[model samples]
Target: MSRLLLLSPLLLFLGLAYLLPLSGVMLQSVTTPEPGLQNYSAALGDPLVWSVIWRTLRVCLCVTVLAVVLAYPLTLLWLKGNTATRVLVELAIMIPFWLSVLSRAFGWLSLLSNRGLINSWLQSLGIIAEPLTMVRNEFGVVIGMMHFLIPFAVFPLASAMRSVDDRVILAARGMGASRMRIFWQIFVPMTKSGIVGAALLVFVFSLGFYIVPTLLGGGRSVMIAELIYLRIFQIPNWGLAAALSALLMVSIGAFLVALIKRAGVSTT
Candidate 1:
């Protein structure tokens, strides 16, 4: 009775703020246009809906891979770095989290625009007479997502890499193991839990992304979140909106379950 009382606040909050609203949306999916599975069936059967899902998955996977590849190297360097170097690297990794997402999106816009810094630098070097299209494309979307998610990958990876014993690495060095062998064999295996956890976090977050894809993508890359926004506001189709919301929730939950089972990693 005491334990239940202690948990009542959280339970009440979830019930009032989250569960109630979620239940309304779920109910709306079936009840809005004559209660049945028709909304889901129509959503699942649509080719355009499938295309959005595929794009979401692809961009998310790309961001996760890029973030992991980039962050893991920094994680390794951080592990080997002196205190000052570690502080600098930690600052670099964490500074993004302090900024607003909208601000970051606008910053990327300024950098990746045709007259932006990168293009100007390239043109000054006689690289190309014309500036390449960086913003309002799939590449731009991935870049935006990566900037935001890199910290997620790094923190988990840093925690995982710390679990690898320094003595084990030294032992491998003493045993004539090549640096490449040491990394592939000894270092990689030790950080599996962190990597998997980070990947799951990245992929799941990317699935629900709205602002980056909307702002950077310029409607060229329509993910589920953008689609939901359009359905609700532009078209005023509550049934379709609710259906997409429900589908997104189910898909994310399913992927999380499969990933946890495959990796045998616990979030706890």
Candidate 2:
């Protein structure tokens, strides 16, 4: 009874803040502009919608793979490096959290645009006469999303890596296991949970990204989130927008459940 009383305020808050809005979205998806599942059927049947879904999935997969590949080395540094090195690595991961998403989007624009610093430097060094088209495309969107997500991937990986038993690694070395052999055969297997957790975290995060895709993609790279915006504000198709929102919410919820299950297993 005491615990129930203590939790009542939070339950009420969630009911108002989350459950209310979600219920509205789900209801709107079916009931808005007339009753039925027409919105969902229309969304699933459209070729353009399928294309956007495919593009979003592709971008998310690319970002997740890149984050895992890049974050592994950094995770290793965080675990094994000296104090100063670890501090620098941690600062690099954390500083972005202080900046606004809009600010980071513009920062990438300045560095990646055709007339940006990178192009200017390359041209000055006679690397190429023509500027590279980096922004306003899928390439640009992937780069921006990856930058935002790598830090998220790193922490999970670091947690997983920290749980690994060092004695097992040393024992492998004592048996004349090469560094590469031990890493591949022993280190990676023990840290598989972290890698899986990080990949899922990054992929799920990439799914909901709107600001970076809108700015960096320059209207050419249309992701599902942007499509939802277009359906809502641009075209005033509330039913379709609500349907997309509900679908995205359901997908993310499924991922969150998987993530929780993974964490529980890791803890056990």
Candidate 3:
């Protein structure tokens, strides 16, 4: 009872700061432009809206996959390394967190553009006659998003890997378990929670990403969040924007619930 009382303030703060704003946004989605289900109907009926949503999902999926693939090997290395080496690797990962997203996006643009560093070097080496179309497309978006998301995936996985006792692996080896068998039977299962958590985090973050996709993707790729922005700021269609925002929130919620269930089952 005392602990519950102590947490009441935090709970109240969340209710006021988080829940209230979210409810207001939801309400606005439904109530705006004469208080009907028209906005939701429009959202469902519009093919363009569906396309944007699908694109957002696709981008998020790609980013999550890339982040997880890269993170797994890095996490393993970090786990096996000495404390000083692990700290250095962690610091390298943390460097991106200090830089702004726009800066990083611009950095990617510099490297990926036709007249950029890669093209210049390749041209000088006579590797190709013309520059590659790397920036302002899906390729650039994926690359930029992966850069941002890899650290997110790595930290959780490394932490989870660290939590897994080294003794278990030694015991399995001592019992004559093959390397592949031990990894599949022990390490993979142990780190499932971290993988799921990292994937969820990356997916959620990428789903709503605006700057990376906008700068790198050009007009070829349109994410739901960007569409929502266009509706609100460009087209001034608040009702539709709110509806799209609500849909994005719902989708994110569903993914999070699924992740929680998977984590629960794994733990059980």
Candidate 4:
């Protein structure tokens, strides 16, 4: 009873800070423009909304796959490295996180633009007669999102890999198992939880990403989160915006739950 009383303040704070704001958003989304289910109906009925939602899902899936593929070798290297090497690699992974997302998007914009660094170098080398259209497209969005998400994927996977017993790998190797076999049959299975968790985290983050898609992708790439922002702030369509926001939240929640279930099954 005493401990419960002591925890009340913390619980109250969480309720106020998190749940309250979420409830307010839900209320606003449902109640605005004369209330009822009109906003939700509009969100569902609009083909453009569905298209943006599908595009968001596709982008998130692509980002998750790219991040996992890139993070794996880096995680392996980090796990196998010495203390100093580990620190250096970890710092390199974290550098992007320290930078602002907007700044990183801008950096990508400069690199991927027609007259940007890559094009300038390519032109200097006579690689192409004209610059490539990398920026203001889905390509730039994926590249920038992967850049932001790789570190997130790496940390969780590396931490999980570190927890895996080195002796297990050695034992498998000693039992006539090749390195590739041991990695696939043993290491990959053990690290499945972390991989799923990281993928889920990256997907959720990418789903709602605005800066990378907005700055790097221009008008060509329209993500759901960006659409929601425009609806609420630019067009002042709070009802529709709120509905979209709610959908985003629901999508993330579903992903998280599925991930947790998979993790549980893998662990079992």
Candidate 5:
């Protein structure tokens, strides 16, 4: 009873700060510019909305796979290395988190855009006759997003890898298992929980990314988040914007529930 009383202020703060705004958005979704499910229906029926969703999903999926592949070796090095090496690896992974997303996106922009540093260097070497369009496309968006999301994947992966029993690995080796076999059959299976958690975290984070896709993609690779922004600010379609917001909330909620369930099962 005492603890409950002590937590009351926090609970009240959450209700006022989060729940109230969410409730308003949800209410506006159905009630704005005439009621019913028309806005939802319009969003679903519009081919352009579907295209944006598909692109978003595809880009996020690619980023998750790339991050996992790239981070796995680095994770192994971090776990197996000396103190100095581990510190160096950790610094490399974490330094990006301290920088703003906009800055990182712009940094990539300067390097990847046509006639940017990369293209100019290539041209000077006579490697290409024309500037390649790297920015304002899916390729640029994927690169920027993957760079930002790798740390999220690495930390979860490290946590999961740490929980793995080294004794099990030794036992597998004692049984004359090859290194490849041990890694594929034993170590990989044990770290499934971590991989799933990391992938989910990266994928969900990529889903709502606005700045990277906006700056790197140059309005060409318009993602769901950017589309939502355009609906509200550009087109002034409040009903559709509210409906899209509701959809994002529901989608993110579902993923969170799944992540929680996965964590629970792993613990048990």
Candidate 6:
């Protein structure tokens, strides 16, 4: 078929560039250290590995939730606003998505540091004699990640909200449904797919984050990606690094499957 021919280039590219490298990693993870599952077994038994994985999942979940909450109101504003306001709001969201990841990470570092703008303003206001610690911690990582992910959440949420039929809302309002009731019952339910899609997008990307977490986490909150980097570059533990990568890939696959199942079963 023409479609099959059209897909050949992408298939070839993935096979050569992506799949080949992943296969190498998979092979290296098991075979380089005497061809057994010992690497995986050790990684599973290590408490540190579990800690890093849990931290990664927790941060990603926090970022996903925060992004959805932050983006939803802005999405509503954009939906209800005049043409000019909507365009400006859209531009604001798109700007961050367009900017470089490292640039945003450093910007967050500058803003969250003890001598940074936020702390300086608080100090000037006499909020506290001692500057509160903000940077190089889990909080800073969450902030940076939310900054990166909010726009991604916004676009999909906005599209879902837009897909909602305005006439249905008006009809509900006419039938004496409260605005809040209408929104809760109608708007949210209709947009579930978009919300899930956006959340999944944010969650997946957050799990794989390197630059933001590295800059903001101050080596205190070790994520899986950072763990991988440390293994490969710092300790030169290729077998362990490959094992971690493989395990992470499997975990991601399982998580996605669980999400799909949950989404399917949920009626409300």
Clashing pairs in 1: none
Candidate 1 lDDT (Cα, whole model)?
0.91
RMSD of each: 1.5, 2.2, 2.0, 2.0, 2.3, 2.4
TM-scores for the candidates: 0.94, 0.92, 0.93, 0.93, 0.91, 0.94
| Pick by lDDT: 3 or 4, better one | 3
lDDT of each: 0.91, 0.91, 0.88, 0.88, 0.90, 0.90
lDDT of 4 by residue, 19-104 (tens): 99989899988899877989999999999998998888888899999999899988887778899988888787878889999899
**Per-residue C-alpha lDDT of model 2 across residues 73-150, encoded as one tens digit per residue:** 988998899999999998988898667889999999999999999999999999989999999998999899888888
Predicted candidate 6, C-alpha RMSD: 2.4
What tens-digit string does per-residue lDDT give for candidate 5 at 19-54?
A: 999898899899989989999999889999999999
Between prediction 1 and prediction 3, the one with superior lDDT is 1
Deviating ranges (above 4 Å) for candidate 6? 265-268
Model 6 whole-model lDDT (C-alpha atoms): 0.90
